[model samples]
Target chain A: MMFYIHKAACISPQQTFGDIDIEQLHVAVDNKLYAIEPKYPHFNGNALRRMSKSTRMGAGAALPLLADNDKPNGIIIGTQVSGMEENGKFLNQIIEYNEDMLTPGSFVQGTPNTISSQIALINNNKNYNLTHVHRGLAFENAALDAAMLVNENPAHTYLLGGVDEISANNYTLDTLGGWFKKEPCPSDGLYNSTTAGSLSGEGATMFTVSGNQAGAIAKLSAITTIHSSDVAVVKERIKNFISKELPDGKKIDLLLTGENGDARVFPFYQACEEILDDQTAIARFKHMSGEYPTASSFALWLACNFVGGILNIPRHMIKRHGDLKSLKNILVYNTHKVGQHGCMLVNVA
Target chain B: MDRIVVTGIGVISAIGHSVNENHAALVMGKTGIIKGGGNFPSRYSGLLPFGEVLVSTDELKTKLNVTQPGVTRTTLLALHAFKEAIADAGLSPDELSAHDTALVGATTVGGMCLTDELYANTHGDTENVEYVRSFDYASVNLFIQNRYNITGVVNTMNTACSSSANAIMYGCRLIKNGLASRVIVGGADSLAKFTVNGFNALRILSDEACTPFDQNRKGLNLGEGAAFLVLEKESDATGKKNYACVSGYGNANDAYHPSSLSPEGDGPYLAMKSALESAGLNPADIDFINAHGTGTENNDEVESRAMLNLFGTLPNFASTKGFTGHTLGAASAIEAVYSVLNIDRQELYPNLNFSEPIADIRLQPVMDHRSAAITHVMSNSFGFGGNCTSLVFSKP
Candidate 1:
């Protein structure tokens, strides 16, 4: 009894939806990353101008498909930085005024719950709403919450989403924090560069989750989280949870990884790859989407599309030689530097 | 199915910093609203009196033996609230092994106060990198985890005003699912320019002492506070004194407006109804309600109407915000702690500043604290993004 994904949309570093043009997306190099330019004007005009990056990305990705469904019973948006740009700008204003004065917009955007708040405002479909942040696991935690909610109430559609953006000051600070790779690499050939840190990027992905199997694009068989510093325990738990929760004897067809340029995290993925080996097609996305807490959302998004029969994997994301044509079941694994781990099982319907 | 019960409660609002002080204030009907301090506007911002705690970080440190600095106001409040909760539960540190106790928290701003200060101190001050770590929720988790050596699942939830409610809900779920044995579920937040300006930008901050349910209720006064409750499964509570039973809880989104609730109050309505249904009790079983009543025009009317629609006639209801102002992430936890207090004492806390009734409904909030044999308390917390939640605590 797995929850199914009815409709999924993503505003990422690639052309995700609405006349998705594969060629138009800006590719990157070893140290550079960028957000895919979706038509914001199409979703909203003046409103788009007013939104912080996270708000705009979430609304653009969710509103198109979400508008057609009857008000969702619950809405949950996840983000690592709710409104970084607005916060920075507002602080800039304060610095200019010497802390004597500041405006409300900066503070409004800084609340961390602003993106979900905006989404709720637009849909007017308030039933249950939540905004979860766990540094890098923000999106996974949100998806897990949505799946659990769907399990509790089988009839309603729950929206699980994640959004964040690159800000000048924030990005600069990230670079100082040893977050991004210093060298550059082509977007399609990100892994070939052998870099250390990932380029900064931003995105939003929304999924319509339901318990019903009929008309489901794909079923989410299982989702699990781990917070252990011991890589051995992390590896064992992944194998244990997946084997226990998913149908046995079905080797995964695809493996979606949150493998940023960081070499330290490769051991965990290496452990995973050794388990399935050639049975699963390997793919990594931090080169395209950059590394953020909720970047796992993009991996899940790509898995959903693959399950939905898109059959197209971004050229820059391939990490191993496996036939994509035979993809049926996809396993997405992601981790943060602080040792938060998450895994989700996606199936072809 | 397992039942979730509240075994311990702790709070630090404007009235007092401990459970005893808060109970005394509630019973005596003493208000905590006062003029703002430091850079905050004292009385001119249409200030409704708030139930604000009267302690600075220095005072908190002196009392709690905390040595950390450059932390956010939110963390300070959280430490105070959690210490009381653990003590009230009689959960001695020596009684359990490390990782047996888990810390689950919710906050709108993890360390915005520190962030604000850092931004101001552009003079190249080499402050501890560990202090800035509080800028995110994990930092808060790390703080408590390291202090108590809690190795269990440590997580944070942020969904506007409903953040802590979700934290509480998740804590209960984790225990129900057998993920952990003992968990601290609650949140803490303090007033900062970020939130004060944010609410002001939305035109929701009250210019005077807030009057929730009043016909002229304009908006809510921002407040500072923290609250926590120890949720233990029945098996874990074999030797413990329980405060209240976590009868039911539900969360819903209005999907209406991000900043304002639905005009019909459908989200709040459904959340309350669902919570009632989950508890296997009818609305009539509710003896009192701790309303979210932020004194905002939209919240009071919509929440009041939703309550009226659910219960027909409003039960004994009041907004503690009229006393403490709104504590944002900590609001629900503060109110939850208050609800436990009222039930434990068999008394009802008054909704201060409630003078006139709104035209939308005939419901009136208790203007003065009342004493009665209370059994069940329904608490509501609605936040931006149409995030609404209702929690029911039944007397043990």
Candidate 2:
């Protein structure tokens, strides 16, 4: 389907809320990389205070794209655990209050669709609104749906987003599950090192995808996901996806991957890297955005910048810098876990 | 466009354990709401009525042969319904694991069914935190996908009560767009203290059974269970036992309140209108309607206004929530199965406990278990965050 991304907004661990800050990059000194939230002007005093961090970040990122642009007919937000921290607090309050007369503040905020619904509530755009909460491919699924919606009615526009927050307690518990490094690791060290657990990060990335090519920054060429853990099966699928998405002579300028320095799952990224063109420049984003399920959205934002020539390869992010005068087709391959894999191709306008 | 049809269906609700059992309960006019469930001990357990499943989590685990630890009741309930749905569709392991078979599941309080475990885990102790992995919003679907080795796009939706309806909608899109040939779609949410207490905190839980559309209805009764439907292209389902054709679906947001629908029911109105438009059918052609009647005063009145605004004179309509209570994410799938049964069986279930209709807009519902010329059945599911969805199922 014809899917073109017009605008992008992100709230991540780095200073990437309203715009991409390429001058300097922030590294996570601790294992958990918290999202650097921007002030939400759409929500007033109590409304902002009541919303969860994920919701605030999601609205803070999504509302700006809708401010001075074509209003989208739909909104789809994706997240692995949007209101997780609120759920934890709500449960704790239930215990403290003895399940008695408790207000609906925390309980209502505990729902996972808080972000998408809050965006709808903020903009008062009563269009098609939905939320996807898959483990790793949540953002990809949302984008796929957005593509379908746009194809159905090319005249209409849609807003898509991915958001997840860092729950301190949950991050610590995740270390027990071997999802986070036992000790704090620097951004550069976590990108290339062979560590058991990777860094845990959270972010909210929002953009407008429309069939209207006017003022488009990049075309969402295609999105594919592989649901396998077997090495051969995943490798075959990766190769097939490259050929299917790229085809003949469509060389990739930049290849961004979700490599968070985990030894067990790094092979999946390697399988993807092995199939890329020899001259393709390599880039990674987990060191900056950490290892959240929807972290691919961050990688996608970075790929969009490279496509628009808004950014050059950072020293710490570049593995093999290619000599490309103008970046064109950028591919983002994110294998969040050993079993889950996602690939997307962004064609510059 | 290739027509998407439901080849198989499965359900696990308070009223029944399987499709046949649930159908039997509907025919016999048996209500599943009871004073309290013996399991999950809470202040309202013995006081307020809830449509809790009869099967215990341990029993479900043993019956389903689930050896995986930390598998919450939500996942177990999903496993029960998913097994039945795929089996009813006569899909083999090879077919299930095929590259074109996608699974779309939805849940609201997914893994939070073990609220105590989550609370303890979220506290300081890391020792007994097995459910830490289960806390993912997509935990139920991921567990099912891994257990069944589903290779296609397996996604999970969590748009409050409208979750599974969107899931079914997305599954059909996957087929029409040539992404997946077959899509397994449904949702599951077992009763959780977090949910029950949350709803209770919202003051929307009724002390008595939920009497949808009734003037005297207080609120809704929280329910628990799971339901799934296997959808495939018409060519792929040619020789299969087809239930109903998934004709059309629509989703919209009210943009009014976080948990309440607009006074005019704009979201529900647009959702139903768009569904009809997509199905190439007029509002008058929708013969039966399965309303998202949570028995809440606001919902019944608002839904009545929306339906009246859409179809001047409403057709045979009822809210099966009276029998199943509010299943939240699973409510759509469970009601979708009921919608299929309404089309295939040519009958309509009465809205239980409903006596007098609402005062201003007195929209009478199907109050008796009787046969009807059920052709196009519309199922409505509206949830928190103003997310509303409608799915139309027609007789095959």
> Which candidate comes out best when scored by TM-score?
2
Q: Quote the RMSD, in angstroms, for model 1.
A: 3.6
The positional error of residue A101 in candidate 1, measured at the CA in angstroms, is 6.3
- Clash number for each model: 41, 0
Query: Given candidate 2, what's the lDDT at residue B265?
Result: 98
Considering the two chains of model 2, state its CAPRI-style docking category. medium
Model 2 regions more than 4 Å off: A323-325
Lowest-lDDT window of 10 residues in candidate 2 chain A? A168-177
Q: Each prediction's Cα RMSD?
A: 3.6, 1.4
Question: How would you encode candidate 2's per-residue C-alpha lDDT over B230-332 as one tens digit per residue?
Answer: 9999888878998999999999898898888899999999999989988999999999999999999888898999999999999989999889889998999
lDDT score of residue A71 within candidate 2: 61
Q: Where in model 1 is the C-alpha error above 4 Å? A: A21-25, A29-32, A98-103, A182-196, A271-281, A322-325, B36-52, B58-70, B90-103, B118-132, B145-153, B175-182, B202-208, B215-218, B356-363
- Displacement of the residue A312 alpha carbon in candidate 1, Å: 3.5
Model 2: C-alpha RMSD to truth?
1.4
The most accurate candidate by DockQ is 2
Consecutive 10-residue window with the lowest summed lDDT within model 2 chain B: B116-125
lDDT of each: 0.76, 0.87
